[model samples]
Target chain A: MEKDHKPSSTEKPVLQKVAKLFLYTFLIVIAVVQVLPLVWLFLFSLKNNQEVFNLPPLALPQDPQWGNYARVWTEGNIGQYFFNSVYITASAVILTVIFASFVTFAITRMKWKLSSLVLGMFMVGLMIPVHSTLIPLFNFFLNVNLMDHPLAIILTYTAFNMPITIMILLGFYYTLPRDIEEAAIMDGCSVHRLFFQITLPMTAPVVATTAIINMIYNWNEYVFVNTFISSDKFKTLTVGIQNFIGQYQTDWGAIGATLMISILPILIAFFILSNRIVEGITAGSIKG
Target chain B: MNKVMSDKKVIALYVLPAFLLLMLLVYIPIVLTGYYGLMKWDGIGSMEFIGLENYRNLIVDSAFWRSARHSLLLAIFSVISLIGYLLVSLVLSGRIKGADLFRKVYLIPMLLSSVAIAQLWMRIYHPTNGVMNRLLTSIGIEQPPLWLADTNIVLYSIFIPIIWQYAGFYILIYYAALRNVPNELVESARIDGASPWQIGYKIKLPLIAGVIKVTIVLAVVGSLKYFDLIWVMTQGGPNGASEVIASYMYKQAFTTYNFGYGSAVGFFLLILCLIITYIIRKLTATKEEVQY
Candidate 1:
């Protein structure tokens, strides 16, 4: 009996090792699948049309053409579009965070008769498809002479992002102990002062999280900018790249370079703030 | 403290700016979208009130139905893919080495804008010089299919990237949820001689049922409203074979200048989303949420 048990135990250990090996391979394969396309994109970006067609798909660029990046930046409106995206994304994220914080503070901290009702309105705003609002917004922007303006894009980003930003902030706000705010108030601090100094400071971690999320959304937003701002000067990278690619449609390296530049900022931000971005995405979605 | 917190003046100052923006932009436009559906107006022209004519045409529009069907197919595909994501999450959440690195690597694609993703994929699907065909030929399959140009498979081809973009997001959510399941419960089940599969399927999944439900709703509604990728990659193209609801609405309003018809379609999409959300919630509502 002891000899039989020993063989079985040894076999079990071997089988478990095999299973573990299989699991790791499975995971690594998925990781490879996810990153390979981007890898190929980066490789192709550094190669000219000849190298791109001649070389293997994953082959390293024999002579990396860094000029592709320079040409796209100088020859196209990519610089202007990049600047527009940066400012638009920054402005919208700032506005969304501030407004969301105020509303969140008011609902979670302040006593209000219609607090729940008001909160419900913003929450339901999440379910309203942006498509439903697109035409009216276009008309509204046209009527108000803001059709081709950057302000139109900024305001729309702020409003559309408000619900999700507030949602992420709400979770953090609810968990915050009101002790310090109450004590500050007991010392005769005003509501505005309490919010600005006490509550807002305490919620900075979540504010950072939501800000990154909003930056991603606003940076990547396509349709509203595509519709409202048709001019090259005001177009964000998403739309700008669309038109830029149209001109350089046959120049694989140039188109690849342009696409890389557009996505690089977000990718850089992701590498730096991945933890916060992950936390933000989980927080924003899991509550649904 | 109560008086300071409840100050009507301060509260109004704090809330009114955001609240008014929400109303002006989101809520008001929704009402206007429905109202605009009752009119005959080419965006820049004077409106002629034509009650329900657009809606009537929408009912008989084969193109709209086809797009709606494509949207539904996408929704189904997204829901089915959730199972694969969940399986991957279950594996990742297990005591695996380098799980964090694996998870983040998977998330890289999700960070990209749809336009960039669409452009990158168009090159991937390029008929003559694409990575896809290159790999196919190297593997000795000479006749690789034209991915986006083929009307028969365009929708399915588009669905692959949609799945790729969202896989990490769903996995991240599930991993977080599965991590939240109490270790003691899992350990106890293991001590009771449960197999690993049983431990995952029987114990972990049931506990994260609520998260699973939310993901289903997200995947479905998100698929129904999926636009940017399809718009960029195919533009509902190969003869409209890949059109989804949002892309179709976009085409009607922005491209074709059929403002009235687009609004009607847009209104229908809004109602469909809300109703589907409500129904999924109702169907998946647990009698009592499992408490640890």
Candidate 2:
């Protein structure tokens, strides 16, 4: 029935208010659920073993012990691991942009014969799940003495992160208008300089998206961190935190404490780039 | 011929570095993972060839089938809830003021590490004095099941956080697609006396079927490879109640160090992913590209 559609006046206001009430209440509940684990994480972080497992779980600390963070930092070497993650993640992001931007230029501007072929090959990597590749990559790393080396994961992360990065930059660079590019070409800018100056600046938003997304992946990564990196110094937060879960016995309080500390970057990133991050993920997936 | 040759080389020059890197990390390993299926290697010693034995045994391995079933179940539940919730969220996004805030709350979990999210869910599902059970009892329920610990509910329990975490991504997808629909169509519907719900179901949904189709496909693919959450929450445990294919394969390769068996499962995963994605690609894609 293509009966022409319209909003009925009588029910509209009532429905709108009811919807508003439901939505506000729902948001309040979601906000609580969203933040509650964090609250539990912080609360447990301060409690001793007795209080952690206490019935009616300790809502707040009777005694606020500041030592758990220290233990996780010193004994856990979370500080060292944090630095290692930052170092590796920084290198990986830089490498990803360098390689991906070059490829994007070749495909979009250089009129390379293998442009489509190159993209097709990288696209294949996206379909093959990580489980299939882990063992061989592990052996390759082992044979090369990259076992527990941050560089090993950095190399692989650059490769694994490429598929999505190329997907993004390819789309972004392709969509760029041609007259400005021709004008730049007339100005004696080389292909490389064109990318860095005119073309690159134009794609700044996408570059930000790619870099932030890659940083997040490298920060929270577990399987690669656990597999290739064995030593304490090399262990990132996810792997380092797992140490608290085992060997002698699990320490719930310390585990919670470490978890609270671990999510700080994500929280800060969310606070700053919440809209951009959501938009990036959706745009990359839906369009690219 | 020279012109064509130079053109090809230029393309090669551009894509070669990225392409070669992928070959090392992705292609060779996948080939090896498949190749190892025929050889019984313990990952430390000489690889002895026993072609198809892993697959033969896998056929009889009840645990493998059980894990596959769980993966399939998780896939179904996640796809249904994720798509359903995202659509509802999209609709609410239309009507609700302060939608940006709701979306932010939803997306916080997605930004954090999967391990962090898992640990969060573990607390949510805690047996005694967990937030979930506490909420239940406060609302007049006497019984509270140990969520991650209980075998039956464990798989579904694992899905809750995943669905919650990922719903935001899908909402963004639908929202973007909704935005692209010409305002005239929506305004016209309003002028023609259709209810908001009617306008959505009739005009909006079918219009964005392509995006919805994609959301479905991604949901399926993402769920199949789902491991991080399952590994963190329950290492396919409490009697292997929540074993996805990836986690089960992980236990073999890393935990038990059975490289050959793990490789065989990895091949199976490859084939499964191919079949699923191929079917989806075929279904969603039209012969002629739809240009807006």
Q: Which candidate has the highest lDDT of all?
A: 1
DockQ of every candidate: 0.80, 0.52
Candidate 1 lDDT for residue B185: 98
Reference-based lDDT, each prediction: 0.92, 0.78
The C-alpha RMSD of each candidate to the native structure, in angstroms, is 2.2, 3.5
Could you tell me which 10 consecutive residues in candidate 2 chain A have the lowest summed lDDT?
A: A1-10
Candidate 1 residue spans exceeding 4 A from truth: A1-8, B290-292
Residue B45 shift from truth in candidate 1, angstroms: 0.9
lDDT of 1 at A215: 97
In model 1, what is the error at residue A85, expressed in angstroms? Answer: 0.3
- Worst lDDT run of 10 residues, candidate 2 chain B, spans B1-10
Q: Which ten residues in a row have the lowest lDDT in candidate 1 chain B?
A: B283-292
Clashes of each: 0, 8
What's the distance in Å from true for residue A88, model 2? 1.7
Q: Would you give me the overall lDDT of model 2?
A: 0.78
lDDT of 1 at A114: 94
